[model samples]
Every structure is written in structure tokens, then in C-alpha cells.
Target: MNITISLKRRCEHVTEGTDEAGSGSLLNRIYTELYITEGQSEEVNTQHEKHIRVVLTNGVAGVGKTFSVQKFTLDWAEGLENQDVSLLILFSFRELNLIKDEQYSLLMLLHVFHPTLQKVTAEQLAVCKLLFIFDGLDESRLSLDFYNREVLSDVTQKSSVNVLLTNLIKGNLLPSALVWITSRPAAANQIPPEYVDRLTEVQGFTDAQKEEYFRRRFSDEDLSSRIISHIKTSRTLHIMCQIPVFCWITATVLDHMLTTDQRGELPKTLTDLYSHFLLVQTKRKKQKYDEGHETSPQELMEADREVLLKLGRLAFEHLEKGNIMFYQEDLEQCGLDVTEASVYSGVCTEIFKRECVIFQKTVYCFVHLSIQEFLAAVYMFHCYTNKNTKVLEDFQEKDWRYSRYSSDSSLDNFLRRAMQKSLKSENGHLDLFVRFLHGLSLETNQRLLRGLLGQTDNSPEIIQRAINNLKEMNSDKISPERSINVFHCLTEINDHSVHQEIQEFLKSENKIREETL
Candidate 1:
């Protein structure tokens, strides 16, 4: 693809855009929305009978691993199930967190399969047949190797290190059925031996693929050719083109930017791409607002951490008085109203969709764990000067960088009503609150909480609460939210765990350490 198209053509037709705050939004929607790209899905159907069991899907962050797993699961259910057999149990390892053992993870999987398990203990699960899709091995905090297979005689005879040594240390954890794992190459060590033999990697779209997808999106051959050239040639855009989201970002950029073809340098870093991309997008969105568009969304804004915190704070403050999922009317109760607010909201939501920040269907969430980390970093650096005050209200395991999109007006309205109506109350709204919390990740949480605690308003209370939660969360009663949050709060900024933004945060501290240490 050439890099010399009009910016509008470059920016059009993205599935969604990427955001640092919007994590988990993309994968959650993948299997449910959009067709699985052919490059990845072609080989999936042939594996229905390979008694070998356990499949693994590998790719970079935004490639189609999770989506493929989901599509496979759905297809498997439609074909593989006979009258006696039923239900596939998919476990996202990202949801499992730093659980102590493969057995522990199995135990958790058992619980999800609990309703299906007639009388099986986690130990008894061996006899019971089921399917497992363990997603996100690379993103997990603990590193376990999976490439080579090994034998495990007994899991009960060892120490903590043995438990962590998954490749050589199998226990009652191995199931008697089908399973799959997904991850990127960088985090390959996190996968255990159980998955190595079953590994599958996602190769990016081919040039013909780009032509097919782009042409479907826009009819003009010359325009599609221009976009294809940019996708093939632009170095930074080239990286994104490898991932589906970047393809969408490319298309969206082509569609809107009037900057015309100035031979400006492309973004060198992911953040550079996002920042430049968002700037051009914000310009186009402002145009829609200027034209005087309105909707039923009560209030919407180009919700960043600042805007979300402001709105969520008021919502939380009001909800602290109770438990509810606030709606348009509830927004009014929170002393928030006016339709003009989310004008940026609806359009900004599209920003998330085009870039693949979240699912482009009815319910969406942040696309990656990194997005929330970035948002938390941004909030700590700029929004709240106080080191302890949390920037969000009613958070949970999955929050939206973008939720699913609906092309139908009625369906869109229905989902919005469902979301808004869900928010009308408090405690019952716990799920609603967490719907967005899904946007945060362990690594991101670890970076944001440990790194930014000093600059927060309620750092002491937050830290203590997290530690206390840790005390309560053991192998027996692990809380997903509790476990991940504790890991987030306790994990120091390990230099080994450096992200692109770490150096920026380290600069001020390095100066002080230079004088002291």
C-alpha cells in the first residue's frame, strides 16, 4: 500500500481506533462482531477431530487471536455437540491473573464449568469432557514456557517454583478434552508446556487481503489503490496494517483528514500515531458538532480520563448514597444534564470503533490492557494532583474503550437504553460499573497504581484497601477484581516491565535519586 493518499481516504473504513485507556474492548467484541479475517480463520475448521486437543493462537496485541478462538468456539458448538455432549468453557487467562498454579486455574475453570459438572471436584474434572480456550498467556504477569512438551508425574510433591514451572509440572490440571491458548510472540514465555504442541499464530493480512477489504469499504479503484499503497509503504502505518485495528485506523485517516498530501513524516511511535491520529479526528468531529446534531444520550463528551472522572465522580458520589446504574434521568440526578455533552460522546465512540479500541458492535470496551495504563498515567500526571484519588467510579474487570456498535438505529437505541437503564440504580449496578473496569489490566494497573500512588489524593487508603483485599484473596477464594487490583497496587515499576511511557515517569524520580542515592 502507498503512503501518499488524501488523509481522508487514509483514515476511512477502520474497524475501530486504538486508545491507551481503551483495553479489552476489542477482543470482547471480535468473535461477536466482524467477520474473522480469512488469513487467520481459514485453517480453524479443519481441526475438529484431532484428538490432539489444546490449540494456541499467537499474534501481536491487536491481531485476531481472541476473535478466532471465539469464532472457533461458536463453530465447534454448532458442529461437535451430540445429544450427550454440550457447552464449551473458555477461560481467558487474563481474567485468571497471578493464580498460584495450573491446578488452581483448572479449579477456577471447574467453577465456570460447575453448573455443567454433575458432581466433579476439580480433581474429578479429568473424567468430565469439555472444551477450554485459555486466552492471553503472553499478557499474564507470571512467565511459563509452552513451546516444548514435558512430563509431570505428580504436582502435589513440589514447592512454589515447581508449581510455576508449568511445562514440566503438570498435575490434576490437565483436562481430558479440547483446549486452546492465545498470545503474542513477546510474551511467549508466559505459556506453559500444555499449550506448546497446540500452538497457532496469526499472520497479518496479505496485499490481496488489503485490496479485498478496502475495495468492499470503498468502491473507487484509484482510491483503494491509494490506500493500499500507503498501507504497504508507510513504515509506522505498516506496523498497524499488520494488526487489524491499524487497518481501520488507516482507512479512517484516509476518509477524514483534509490535510491533503503533504509529505510529512509519519508517526514514529504508537503514541505518536495515536496522538496525531486523534488530533485529526477531533478536528473532523468538531465539524459534526458545529452542524448542530443532537441525540438522546442525555450528555456525552469526548470522554478522556478527565471528562470521565468528572462525570463518573459525580455519578459515584451520588451512587455512594446508593447502588444503581445511572441513566439519562440519573445523570440529571447527579446534577448532570444537557444533550450537548456526548455530542463528542457518540462521535468519540466512533473514534474508538474505527481504530479497534473496542468491539464495533452493541457493547464495547477498551481494546488493550495498555490503554487504561496510559489513561491512568495521564490522569495522575495531569488530572488529579492528589496521589490517592481514583480517577474512575464503579470500576470492574471490563470497561469500554468502545463497546459494540449497532448499524441499526433501533438496536443502537435499545442497547443504549439498556446501558443507561442499567445505570439507574447503585449496588445492583455493580456489573454495570465493572462493565468498563474490564478496560484495565494487571500490568497497566500495576504501572498506574504503583507508579502514581505518590501523586494521588487517597493513596494510603487505596493501598491499604488493595493490600487488605490481597489478604482476603487467597487460592481458595480468589476475587478477579481483588487479585488484579492487589497485583496492580503492589507491583513496583520493574525496569524489566518498562512500557513506552515509563521513561517519562522516571525522569523526575531519576533526578531526585541522583541527588539522594
Candidate 2:
């Protein structure tokens, strides 16, 4: 009804950055500092008292809710008539997973409070007017820890859910009076109803806003004009901009796509847009060869290439292997560097570097979806036991019927070839080894083995090399128990298959009996 309501709606229009719309993310700061939360002038500051401003802003992810919230907090704080009393404290629920206990949550608040107030009491927080921006309800803690280990207990309120709800309703952690709870509707439903205000969902950017965005990305005025005109007339482009993030993604993608693919047509959907983006990235890499510039992200890519190719080599050896999720920390022992932040190539590396690789739970597959499929398909090909020639041919040869699989199959095939090239060490990524894999538990290492190559019985031809390596690991270096563990992981994928060869293989090797017994 008022500007605050209007402000909430306007926030949805932004795809990038602002206090309300962002978690103050440094990555790809869209910085859309435009949202007005009505003339809540009286609401926020009643008769110059500065009514505890509980600013509730909510919208879908990538809709820029955090960005708007951040902008509002800074602006409101700057505009405040009184400096000492009015303060904006920003908190994110995502970070609480590390310490989910109520006392710990209070400790976090007290700690933050102490930094500013210098031994200020928690009781004092209520007396003073404070502006708090609690963000990322959707990403809150599912569990908590004590002494740095997830102190798992059957306590419900002791659970992350209770800690958050208690703080909002009873604890009044942001008790400064004004609390803004922002979340997507689905996520908003998660928070206790008593504290949060009426639900407000941001309705993304308008057509004119998208046009302006595209104009900014494009340097050429004429090109920008023509593009906007084309987008307005085009059915797909007009439909795509219904949300802010999509608009930004579309604009960013289209800017690059139209330039390289300038000769032909424009991409319609996000999929085509991604394909074009990948292609542009591919082209950007190719520029090195033409100009002969040696160092680039390609160096990192080349090393990554080797590991993926080795993974493919291992996978083709074991396609009928059980399970798909490969835990990386377990895959690379000496345990991924145990810190709070891992160094990343970005602007905020310094702030986040100390805590890197504390990833006991962070599992990753290949970089892209297409690459994962490529590895799967490559592994499937080597599994001679899966003699469904049609399925094998479907993945490998790409005959007429196979061609009908999906357009994405080509991209999958693309990664396969890329890895295959790297495997040969002909192009891309010279370092084929994942140094971490050597340190995994014999159990996990055996599992990765199974992921690459099937059990001993239905094993594929390409996996012969890997099999030889496992045999060497078993006989020459390791103990018998570890070798048997690996053997179990591979063959267990089809312990009950129809193949008599496999049945006999399992029986003679005693693999099935080992796990079951």
C-alpha cells in the first residue's frame, strides 16, 4: 500500500545487489540500489524515537532480496538523525550450521555485540533501538556442533529449527524492535509465524528495466536498441524476463552470444543461452592458441582435465559399480586442509581464505552436468558385461537412434572427447592425478575403483589397466583386508545379476559372502 510495500515489490525487480536483496555477496555484485519500502518514515522512526525498525523483506533466490536489504540498512543508518543509538546489524542463517545450539547462537550474538559495544550486556540490547537484517532463512542450520564436532542428539529445540524460532519469538535476539525476516515463500513457511510480518514476495523486473539492463551491458547504442526491440517482439525473450535473475542471466549471456554468434540467429531459451556461454568460454580459451599466451585459467583446467580423464578411465573400468555420489574429501585424504575458508579466485579471498577445505560433507562430481554424463557414458562403454549393445551404442557410437537421445547428449559427448583428449595427454590438462585420492580410506578408494570399473567378473576391457593397478596395490604393497574391501565395492553393484559368469566370479572370489557375513 505504501512505499515499504512498493519497496518490497521493487526489490524483486533487481537481479543483483542491494542490502535487502543480497547477503552482501561479493560475487557478481549486480548492485541494483533501487527499492523503496514505502514511506514507513513514521513506522521506522515514530516521532523521532526511531521505532525499533523490523524491516521484513522476502523474495525468491536470485531475485535480489539480500541486495535490497543491504542497501536499505546502509541508507537508513546513514540517514538516521541520531548516530550512536541507531545501528544496523546484519546476520545470515547460513553460517549458523557450524554452531546450532541456543547458547552458541546467543554467544554469536554476544560476540558480535561485544565487538561494537565492548563488553555490552545482552539485556542492554533490548533497551537500545537496533536495526537487524536476518537473511537466508532458507539456508539455516539443519544441525549444530560442540567442540567443533556435530554434537548429534535427539533434542528437537536443541536442533537448528528451535534455536532460530526461539531467537525470533522468545529470545528477541534482534530485540532492538525492528526485525526484517526475508525469505522465499517456501522458505518463509519454515520460520515461526509469531515474529515474522506478513509475507511479501518480490515480483521481478519490468520490461523497461530489462531493456535498460541490456543497454548497459552492450556498448553499442544501436545494437542495444535493436536487441531490445527484438526481445520485445520475440515471444521467448519476453517470457524469460518474468524474474530478475533470469533477466540478468539472459542479458549477460546474450551480450556474449550475440557478439560471437553475430552472424546467425539469437538463442531463445536458457539452455541455448548456456550452450552459447560455454561455447564463448571455449572460444575465450582458444584465443590463447591464436595469440600464444601461455598462462590462463587453462592451467588450472589442464590439471583438472587429467583428474577427470583418469576418473573416466576408472569409471569405464567399473560401470556396473554401486552408487554415484563420490565424496571428494574421502577421495583425497590428508583431509582437504581443515580451515574455515578455502581460497578462491575472487575479490574477497582474504576474508575467506583461513577456512578452506573443512569439507567433510562437500562432495562434488565433475564440473558440469554434461561432464558427469560423459564420465558415466564412458564408464558404461567399458563395461562389456552390460552387453545391451543398443544402450552401449546409444552412449558411445551415436548412431541414428542414439542421435535422438537429446541435444544435451552432444555436450555430454563433448566432455567425453575432451577428457579422452586429455587422457591421451594430447591437449588440455597434463596433471591427470587427483593427489587427494591417494589418502582416502581403503574403503572409499575401493568405492571409487568400483565407480570407474565394474567388479572382477563383468569387468570391461578398458579397465584392464586399472585392474592391474588394483592387483598391484593388493599384492605388493597393501594388506589383504583392504584389497578385499575394494573387491567388495566393485562386484557388489550386481551381486544378484542374471549373468552366470558373474555369479561364479562372485562365489569363487567370496566377495558377496565377505560383506554379508
Candidate 3:
């Protein structure tokens, strides 16, 4: 999908006004235009002009920042755009993290990753125009000591990978080279604001673009139309379609439900949709790798339960630490081997993926942050069902007085404790995780993933208690943003009373205002 890019100038004193007009389709065109404009402005202007050297682009996960970087590099190599640059080097932080402990000169580092650059001397690099693109700063495990790292101007001087990167970004090495970095918003501050000349944000897709995506996604006009209509029916889904990955997920779930004989009511809640999506991917895996004989959804899940749970464990552990990327050791910690990880990745390629970086090392991560959150919730619920007190205690450390280990601890109380913990998060990283946790409390969703989740008390009494707890949650105790998530949790559990009450209250307030006017 084509993403919208908004540009902003980062000044020493304050951020300059955002230039929405500069937003463009291709990343290459956007950077090239800015570079060319700055070059032209330098000749005629006497005042000091900011040279567009380092551009930091921020976007949430699955918002297509990496895709834009790939497209930009491709366009440059194809000579369709940005021909002014003599060399373009792209590096992902995930790959860089593999060599974080190694020491190498900047030139040597280039040679190690891109052998074609081995013959290029420091003198040649000084004269040639170059662009260095670093993708996925959010995945970096490197300690970027930007402020305290010793300065190294010589590209041939050996230093730690972290030091080399810090110097390069600070313009102490290869000062003339243009540097571009892409990161999710959470990790964008790794590079100090003073080093960034321009800040760009990738706003995934506009409403018109969303419609265009669906139209192109399906060849059948009727199916595409129906999917689009269904998406529009839910405000939450429509807003989430702004992320291209979520659009793909929606299409995958809806398409399977519409085309198959399992024509049940269309999914309305996020949990409902994800449950169907999990089944769909499992079915696809069976069809591809197993015998041609059809099997029930429960049987398919049963076959893959071990691997999925291992993955879920991985997701849960990392979710607690606010980590999305995983290495071999991370997987090993969760009792997952490379082979098991491969099987799971093969099953749900979009949900989990393994990328072979430079050398033979591989990096693993969920396709989107939301997927990690969902799986983490599933794993946490599994722990609760199996009476895994250790995991529960670790999660609810601050609420140990709540008797989480007691047999009488209900799903409502467990979810309330999780919700409280999520509210304590300043970044709200656990918001979706808690939402998914509440969603899993519903018997409908539990039944959908019966095999994977195992047995749970999703009885009506428990479900109603959970919904009531959500309704009674004090909005004053949390930020306005988090309060909205409480409402979302209610929606996920198929409760509409809170929504109806809010609408009625708004109507009454509006009528009173009209009378006063």
C-alpha cells in the first residue's frame, strides 16, 4: 500500500510547522525533492540554511515505513529517481544487532555487509555522494552511546559497531553522506533530536487509499464490495484499516468466512475476527503441508498446539518487556527451537516471520505489534486456565494481595488486575494486550479456540461479571486515552450498554445546550 509521508523540520529551539503539502507517494521523490531544493537554496541564500543530512522517519509498526524504505532504495537503484546519489547503502538494525559486539572500522563494516564496497577507499567515499539508510531502529539491541562515545573521524579507524554508528549519525564519520533512519515512534528518540534535520511520519493509508487497497486486493468485484461494506460497518475496524497490515488481516478473515460453508455471523469484535483468522491460517498450513484429507478446526489446532504455545510464551515474555524483536536465544528461552519456530512461521507467515539478515543469523518478530499483543493475551489466559501461579504472580506482582493464586479467583478479577496494570503503563503499550485478555473472557471466543486455550470458566456468570467490572471502572483513575480502552474492552466482550448510555447522555447534554442557546 502507498503510505502518506508528513514532513517536519526539527529546529534547536522548537519544531517547525509541519509541511503536509510536502507529503508525497514515493519516498525517493520526497527525499530527492528536499535534497535538490536545499542545494538550490544554498547558492542564492546568504542566511545559514539547514542541510538535509539526516532524515528520521517515524511510524507505528505495520504502517509501511520499512516498505517505503525498500521502495525508495529500489527506485534509486533502477535509476527511476534520485540518480544524483553515487552510492546507496541500506542496513536494518536487526542485522546490525548481530554484529553489535564486533569491532570494525566504518569502511570495514561496509565491506563486511556489502562486499562490493570493499575496494572503495576512504578518499573515494569522501568525494562521492552517498546515502545510508538504517531501517528498524526499534529492533536495535545496540547500546547507542550517542553523547559519550569517543569521536572517530577516520572511516578506517576500528571501533565498536555502536561507536561507529554513533559517530556516523553525529557526522563525525563520513560527514557528507546523507543518512536516513526509520523507526517506530517508541524508539525514535534513540538518536537525539539535535542530530535529526527533518522528521517525517508515515501515515499508513488514507480513506480513499484504503478503499483502493480493498478493490485491488480481491479480483471478484462482489467480494471486494462486500468486504469494504463490512469494514465500514464497524468504526473500530474502519479506523484500524488505516494500517495496511490490519487491512490484510480483515480481508483474510472475511474472505474465508464468506467463501466457505462455515457461514456464521460475520465477526464484529476484534477478538472474534482474530479467532477466525487463527483458524484460517491453521487450515491453510494443513492444506499446504499435510495430507489432502480435510480435518476439523479443533484437530488442526491440536496438531499445532505445542508450537503455537511456545510462540505464545515467547510473545508473552517479550510483551512484558515491551520487546517485539526476538533472536535465537529469545526463542530458546521460551522452549522453542529453530525448527519449531520455522513451523509456526510457515503456518502463519503474516502473524510471525523470520528474516535472514547478513551472514547466517536470523531475526524473528510478529508481522504487527497488535498480533504480538493478541498472542500474549492468549498465552496469559492459558496460564490462568492451567493454574500456572508462577506466571500469574510475575504478571501481577503489584497486586499480590488480590489472591491471584486462590481457586476462587474469577476471570473478572483477573482481568481487572490486568487492566489496572495496563493503566499503570505510561506508554499504554499494554492497552491492546489487556483488551485482548478481556475479549478472550467471552465464551464465544473461547469456543472458537477451544483446543488452543484448553478449558476455561467462560460461563455466563463470569462473562457478565467481567462486563460489569468494565462498566464500573472509574474513568478518573486513568488517562482519557486509557479510559477509551476500557470502553474498547467492553466492546470486545460484546457489551453495548456503555456505548448506548454514552450516546443517550450526549443527546441529553446536546438538548440542554440547545435550550440554553
Candidate 4:
């Protein structure tokens, strides 16, 4: 769980020559030098540091941001570091969302969450040096209206949770207290730059760290070496290993495949890997909960098909709206009951996670965003195979020509429309979803997911059509960032023509440059 973290100062704006090659750049250089690793020391080392009142940390989903926050809190509680502060209050946005509508004075709020503090008077709280850690701003449901909200400077004054949070962050309430906020990159801007004294990022793992992660995970040296070597062979897998969660997924999958007698080539493509992962989880669920009966992979999946599809529906609907966190109501909306949802976490802990933030109110989310995308794709494909035209029509609203009743609803046409829809997205959030959709089209993946997907048209012509559609996709209109995904889709389908052509083109260009030199 230990990963590398890089700390840097927040820059309002970047311009050429601002820190260009001079002693003036020393300030920026000092920030870059601050790297923290859990294995090294409990203390964070910094040079030429100033008093940091409010810090904002941003990292991608599943990049160990929450882990770092937990470690910091644990270290503080154990008196391993930062003993100067009298009190440290850790508030995750997920838990805070439960009481977002309630009004409480700063003192009352503290007393409610920490009952031990109920006896502490407001006068005593005002003088105590405190640090407030707000984690997962991306999952917040509260309206943090910092600009227009009325501010109360008194600790005894009652107000909405939003107001209290804004006022505290703005230094209007308890200005002497230190504040630390963590969020995904997209949601980091929620806290205005003026309120942040420093910015840090959880960079996940370095190359050396990735190797160490596998070595530590597996007790068998040979197994760990094989896992590391296999990961290195796949460029996509190696790059994804940089994210700690993805590394765990990779380890889980490879370990299951290598240790078991199941006969097949190691999964190279994302779709193939996930397909195996699903099967592995199902098998584990059976062994753990179902009297240890031996069941075929398909039967294992069939046993959990209904609940998995419900979860998939939840993943697909929320993924469209860019929501990763889900409430109990959200789960019910997708036809998933509390008992059914718990089965997922109880069995496949890494695939789905449920956290009891406070008051026994649980919050749920897929372990990683990519898994959500994968499940969403699975759900979408299931809809297609069942001819659930209502779902398809809702997804493909712009394409009036392709109706639910239309006879031309082939895999190629369906996937092409999905590609077009994903490209239209401004932030490319749907890029991975679309890639997973295309990946699911492969006959190999279809067979692997046959239990959940039901009967599919796995004819050679149908599969070829889907592959050809991806290869001939027009990329000129889209940004290069999104365009690269088309090639990834092609890779998923095991079509390497585009990749080989690119390699040849690069080689020829290099040869021409060599001749000119």
C-alpha cells in the first residue's frame, strides 16, 4: 500500500520565463525535491518551508490518495508524527454528505462526530491548535458555495454544514487551524486557489516501486518474478501498473491464472484480463460462500448473473453522469438491494467496495473507475444481446436513423455509434467506456462473458465487421488524445494492422533522417 507522493506549490498561472533557468527557479526546484514514501520514514521532509495553513492534494482515481490520508491519520493517532497539534479531525466527504442538510455550530458538529469532545467548551476549542483533513472532495454531495454564502466567525454560531465548511476553508472561522483537502484532479478546482497555501499530488508508484509491489505481494519469488516479467511484456499493463489499484488488479488476475490449473494464455488485452478477473471472483465467491462445491466458470457466473447485471446497470447509469460514488437510493434505483450489493463486496472485495462512513450509513463505489467502465460495457452488451431497444434508444438518442425496430442493428453499427457518442464528450470521460465496449465485442471476450451476456452472434463475419469498423474509424475530427483510443480498441480486438503500419512508418522516417545526416 506504500506509494510515492510528490509535493508541489499551487501555481495560479504558468507562463514562459516565469522560472526560466535562473536562481529564481530555486523556489520551484525546492518544491519538486519533496518526495515522500511510507516505507522510508514516517516524517515528510521539505526544504525552505513556509507555514502551510491550507493544502490541496489532487490525484487520479485509485492512485492511493485515500490510503495516504488514512496513513497520515493513523500516524498522528499513534503519536508517530505531528504531535504539536492538540487535535486532528478527519472528515471524509462521503460521511459528511449524510449530514449535509443539517445545521450545527462548529462546536456542536465536533461534539456530534466525536462524542468525547461533547464536554469540551467552545472557549476551550477556540484556543486548541487543530488540523482538519477533508478527504474525497470528488465524492461530495454538498453545495460548497464559497462565494455567495454568509460566513460566521464565531465557533458557537450555528449554520449549514456547507456554510461552516466554506467559512473554515476561507479562514473566516478558526483562521489559526490548518486544513488539508484531497480530491481527484477534476474536482480539485472546487476549492479556490486563493484558499490553498500548498498543492500536493499522490503520484502512485514509480517503476522500481511497481516491481517491489509485486515482490511484496507474492511470497514465492518465482511467481512474483513471472508476474513482473509478464506485466513488463505488455506496454498497456506496465503503464497501468503505475496506478496502485491497477497493480493490485493485475496481481490478483495473474496470480489466479498462474497458480491455478486453468489452461489458457495469460491475458494481454484489457478485456481479456478483466474477463478472467470476473471468472476468478466468481470462483472465489463459490468456494467461500457456497459450501465449497466445484462449479464450472459459466455456472459460477450464472449463479450471480442477476446481481451482477444490476450492479452493471448502476455502473452504466452513473458513469454517463460522471458519478463514481453511490448512495443506498442509487443502488435501489438500479434494482440492487442491500443484501445483493453486500454479496459483491463480501466476495469480490477488490471489484466493489462498501464503506460505512458514519451512523451506519454505507457508501458504495467500484474499486477503480476502469472496473466501473468495464462493468458498464458488460451491461450495455447484455442489453444489446437481449434486444432491449429501450436502453439502446436512450443511449443513442442523436442517431434517429437507427431505431430499436430497425433490422440493421448489427454489432458494427452499434459500436460505431458508441464511438461517435464517446468522441462528442468534451472531457473524454466516456473514452474508456467506449474502449471497453469495443473490447467486449471480440468473440473471445463474448465467450468468457457468455453466462452474463447470454447468446451472442459470435460468427466470424460479425466479429470481422466490428474489427474493420474500428480500424477504419475517422480520427481527423477528434483530438489526438481521444483518437489514440481507437487504436486501443483495435488492439483489444486483436487487430494489429494499424500498430504495424505505425511502426513501419516510424522506422522509414528514421531511415530517411539517417540518410540525410
Winning candidate number (lDDT): 3
lDDT of 4 by residue, 1-517 (tens): 1101111111212211112111132222212111233221122323213777888887777777766776666556656778898888777888888999988898888777665566778777689899998999988888888796597899899999999999998889998899999988667767877667777788878888888878876889999999999999997788778787788788878998787676768888888888887877776766532233343656767877887898899999998887888998998898888775454542345467676756888888886788899999999999988988788888875554555466568777888888878878776778888888877888777777788886666567877888777766644767887778888888787778888999999999999999999
Candidate 2 lDDT over 414-517, as tens digits, reads 22332232233321111111111211112222222333323322233323433333334434444444444333322222121224555688797797678788
Top-scoring candidate (TM-score): 3
lDDT by residue (217-320, candidate 3, tens digit) is 68899999999999899977888888777887898888887876664688878988888878887777665312323436567778778888888999999988
- Model 3 TM-score is 0.84
* TM-scores, one per candidate: 0.43, 0.47, 0.84, 0.82
Alpha-carbon local distance difference test for all models: 0.40, 0.40, 0.76, 0.75
Any residue pairs clashing in model 4, and if so which?
Answer: none
Task: Give the worst 10-residue stretch by lDDT in candidate 2.
Answer: 431-440
Where does candidate 4 stray beyond 4 Å?
1-51, 287-295, 339-350, 399-408, 458-477, 501-517
* lDDT score, candidate 1: 0.40
- Greater-TM-score candidate between 2 and 4: 4
Q: For model 2, what is the C-alpha lDDT against the true structure? A: 0.40
- The CA lDDT at 390 in model 2 is 61
- RMSD of candidates 1 onward, in order: 18.6, 19.2, 8.5, 10.2
